[model samples]
Target: MGLSPKSKRRLQRILPFGVIWFVIGLFVLFIQEAATGNKNINPNVVITLTPKVFVFAMISVTIIGLLVGAVEILWLGKLFNNKTFYKKIFYKLSFYTFFLVLTIIIVYPFAASIELGLSPLNELVLNKLSNFLISLDFLSTLGSIAVSLFVSLFYSEISYNVGDSVLMNFFTGKYHKPIQEKRIFLFCDMKSSTTIAEQLGHIEYFKLLKAYYSDFTNAIINHSGAVYQYVGDEIIISWKFEEGIKNNNWINCFLAMKQDLHKKANWYKNNFGLEPTFKSGFHVGEVTTGEIGTLKKEIIFTGDVLNTTARIQGLCNSHNVDILISEELIKELKPDNSLEVKSKGIAELKGKEQKMELFTVSRSS
Candidate 1:
């Protein structure tokens, strides 16, 4: 499965630390072997680390890591999104605990096996249990656990900071700022979002919204669209079209988005006695695209095109239509006979001076 940018960044962040720990574990094993007056380190270390054993260890670590990360990212993070002090402490404590448990479970055994080599099952078990209890009293255990936890949490924070910095530099910095030009914008808003929120309550409503957002945004990204912003009930996405013309990719993008929404509608109806629906509008025009704002710079699109798209989407509520495409967009797509379009005539938009033509597309041919 494809991971989100955030997930990918987290993995990238954790990987170096994992590798470093693996190396340090190997180094300690080397030192222990040398201290025994051994002539050389194990040449076939990779072979000595049995594939089955390593695979089992990796799988265990992955499962545990996922569980811990989920608890940290989803549960605890959500509980205190607004409370900075408590959230920081909770995250630190959770990170330390997770790292300690995971290291003890996954790393300690490997270290013991390397240090002692292969031994009888009974001896191995006795040695491990004895060491486990004794190690609890050793300062080395506490120090190593503290170091590992600190490293892991530090890596995670660094990754987030670095990724944000990179994105900001690329989008907002002087080098690439010139490429951040205007483009077509689209915004889709869920109808009766407040009603759903009221019915579901805050927690349940957030869960539903998360699912909806993930599904819809996945579709958008698949179509080479960038989701810039998500308001309370709406998402603003933009795609750069050459010469303001809609291509096959853009059409496929809309189709995928609509299909995603349709699936969510079915899910909402089945699960919550609520049918989820949304109205979307697309506009083709010039709009600046780049990272904006000084204190909290954000990647965004700005101009009349964005506002017009929102306005057109709002019109869907009154027009009784689910999708609306602007005339400028239609010119780029070349409306085919397979789809039916009804002209709503020209009307001046909220922020625009000139009247723009709008049309609603339906399945009826």
Candidate 2:
């Protein structure tokens, strides 16, 4: 199968570190060789910082960066997910420090042997490695690595919290001034959330909400949906107009989420004594998008579409359906055999003067 958007995004996040380290390696090499005219103190070692040596160093450091980034994302991130900020930093630094030390122990011997044109087991090479490990050069390299690690980790944390696109927009000032853009929105709300909270109590219900929201991550990312907001039990996801319409990603995303939740029904039942379900309303329209606020800043969308979407979602129970879409958005969806859509006819939506034609959507078995 082809890679999902989520997988592609993960790879995108991981690869940049290697490229960055490759550049850093080049800069460091230039400073040491061309700028400072530094030379190796050990007479046994013959390899100087030539272009070939620089290339080797760049490739090696890039490989190290790839390995470190992969570990941070796949292993350490999940391991320290629930940890406090400072605690997570401390633990990650500790583990990576040890990892770097171990890497030096294994790689330095081979590297030194190559330079000396001798076996890694040679006494002369071993003696040089011993001196190098204790020398100021090793300490300096370690210090540089430490600084890079801290900065990268900080960037990753901020990116994760604010979202990649949002952070980029902030840096690029794309949304600094309010701009009009057509976008698609999916307003998804939990079914009978208040009743569930009452039954489970506040704390347990909070846990369920957490799990519920977490389960939607794969489906959202896989479909290229950006979560706009998390208002209690409801999550609003947004997509570019073309993105949502292409391959019917907007509807497919909802179906994927439904499938995922159903697949985990047993687990939910075992843990929470019940399984949670959600209803969503889809609408597409032009909205004013911009960065707003003084004390606490945020990128917000303001338009009638949002209100209409929420109203559509509110009608879910009245219609005894789990999904609803505006007539205009329905026209945008390509005809597909996998989905069955039925018109609910024109109706006066609450607090709105204009009548709207709505539709209920379901997966065709």
Best by lDDT: 2
- Per-candidate TM equals 0.55, 0.89
Candidate 1, residues 1-365: lDDT per residue as tens digits? 67754465445444555554555444544554467565323322211334455555455444444544555454554455455554665667665565666556555555446445654244663466455645433345456445544554454444444443344356346434634465667778888988889999998888787777877755665565666677987887766676234334455566677777787776778777776777888887776655556797555566677778888887887778887888888777755666677898776677678878888776563
The candidate scoring highest on TM-score is 2
lDDT of each: 0.61, 0.85
Q: Give me the displacement of residue 114 in model 2, in angstroms.
A: 7.0
The residue-by-residue lDDT of candidate 2 on 1-365, one tens digit each, is 77878887788677766866677766766666664457754454323664555566677888988888899887888899998888888899999999988887777776666666789899988887777777777887788778767766776677778887887788789999999999999999999899999999999999999999999999998899999999999999999998888789999999999999999999999999999999999989999999999998899999999998999999998888899899999999898998888999896788899998999888887
Which residue pairs clash in candidate 2? none
- Per-residue lDDT, model 1, residue 230, is 76
- Model 2 residue 154 lDDT score: 73
Candidate 1 stretches greater than 4 Å from native: 1-180, 243-247, 264-266, 334-340, 362-365
In terms of lDDT, model 1 sits at 0.61
* Per-candidate clash tally: 2, 0
